[model samples]
Every structure is written in C-alpha cells, then in structure tokens.
Target: MRSERPFSVFVDEFDAFASPAFATFLNKGRSSDFMIHLAHQTLSDLNRVSPDFMGQIMGNMNVRYIFRQDSQPDLGKPAKTR
Candidate 1:
C-alpha cells in the first residue's frame, strides 16, 4: 500500500542488500510520496556495495543527520539545554 504523504524508509546495514533496485528507486522516484533513509556503520560497508552506487545514493539524500558518541552527551551543554 502507498499514501500521498511521503513515507520514510530506514534501511539498516545498507550494504547487506546490495540491490541495484534501491539505486534506481531513489534515483528515479525521488519524490514526496516515497523516501529512503539509509544508515551504515562504516565507510567499508558502503564500499562493499560499489563506490559508484554509493556516490549516487549519497547524492540522492537531501538531509543529513549525524550523531556523536561522547562520554557524556550533556557534559558540555550550556544553561537549560534540552
């Protein structure tokens, strides 16, 4: 089933699939109705899928989210941080 609103798809360990279908979907169907979210542990994971594919995949992503693994996440926060 599908919807008019964009649905977010989170793919964990992106290299495991190694399916070109994903590349085609993200490339040709880059619209609001469907969106793909990809995550990988390391650069090697993506490399395993093919460098060219990786580049094209990365380019398809409009937003980038990053996280930090510090000892204490709130340690350096200033007054009344959420």
Candidate 2:
C-alpha cells in the first residue's frame, strides 16, 4: 500500500526546497511520472539543493546513484571545494 504520510512530507519539503522553475517543471508532469522525472532531474543536478538536504532526500528514497561529477564532467567540480 502507498504511504501518504511520507509522500505528503515529501511534497511539503520539495516545495520548500526546490526552485520555482524546478517546482513548475515537476508540477507540469503527471503525478505518477513526476517523481521519476524529478528523481532523474534531481540526480542530474544535485547542486540545486543544499548538500545536507540532498543527502536527506536521497536517503529517504534509498537512491544509490544520484548522478556524480565523475559521470558528468560538464557539471564541473563541487562548488564548496573550490
């Protein structure tokens, strides 16, 4: 069965953390498809969120690979490190 509690929490937190453009992008998609799309987009651009928050989101999703700098040289090095 689906858990509304976690999903609700996710929506609230997402709205708080995501940019207006990113949120708009997510809302335009189908609900069933949005999470998958969001996950993909988020993985592709982890810098969109704070590292601590990103870690929390990934942990909640049990995500293994949220796109890495090693995978995409175009993203450049970690901002904080520079």
Candidate 3:
C-alpha cells in the first residue's frame, strides 16, 4: 500500500547533509513513493564527505543534470581527489 500523494524531498548543498543512512534510504525509498532531489556544486563536495560517497550517489540517482562548470572533468572517468 502507498499514499496517493507521493512525497518528495529536495536538498540544496546535499554534500553538507549527506549521510550513510540517507544513502541507504535512497535505495529503499522508491517502493514507498519517496523522491529525493539533491544538488551540489561539484563532485569534490561528495569527496569531502567520503571517498566512495560520490559513487554511492551516482549509482542510485535515476537522472543527472550537470550545469556549466569552470572545470568539467570527464564524468565518465573516475578521477582521484586529494
């Protein structure tokens, strides 16, 4: 059973708010009609949180939209960060 009205959560500067528990929810929330929209300036934002955080997000997200950036690294390729 599910609610007729779906629920949605949008977080700006998601890197500041990311957590392992939340990342887990991203995988399980779909069945309950939960939707999440996250925004961040760069992948580095994720790297600052955890080494594998970026991969966790990119893997779960259904769609991605990248805006114009000063340095556009090849998103298809993995890049190391300090």
**Best-fitting candidate, scored by TM-score:** 3
Best of the candidates, lDDT: 3
State the lDDT of candidate 2 residue by residue for 20-64, as single tens digits.
455444444334333422333334354455444444334334223
lDDT of 3 by residue, 1-82 (tens): 5889898989998988888777888888788787989998877777666778777877787767777455455454333321
Q: Which segments of model 1 are wrong by more than 4 Å?
A: 68-82
Let me know the TM-score candidate 1 reaches against the reference structure.
0.64
Q: How far is candidate 3 from the true structure (C-alpha RMSD, Å)?
A: 4.3
**Which residue pairs show backbone clashes in model 3?**
none
Superior candidate under lDDT, 2 versus 3: 3
Best-to-worst order by TM-score is: 3, 1, 2
Q: Candidate 2: give the clashing pairs.
A: none
Q: Which stretches in model 2 have alpha-carbon errors above 4 Å? A: 1-38, 42-44, 63-70, 73-82
lDDT, model 1, position 55: 62
Residue 41, candidate 3: how far off, in angstroms? Answer: 0.6
Error of 1 at 28 (Å): 2.8
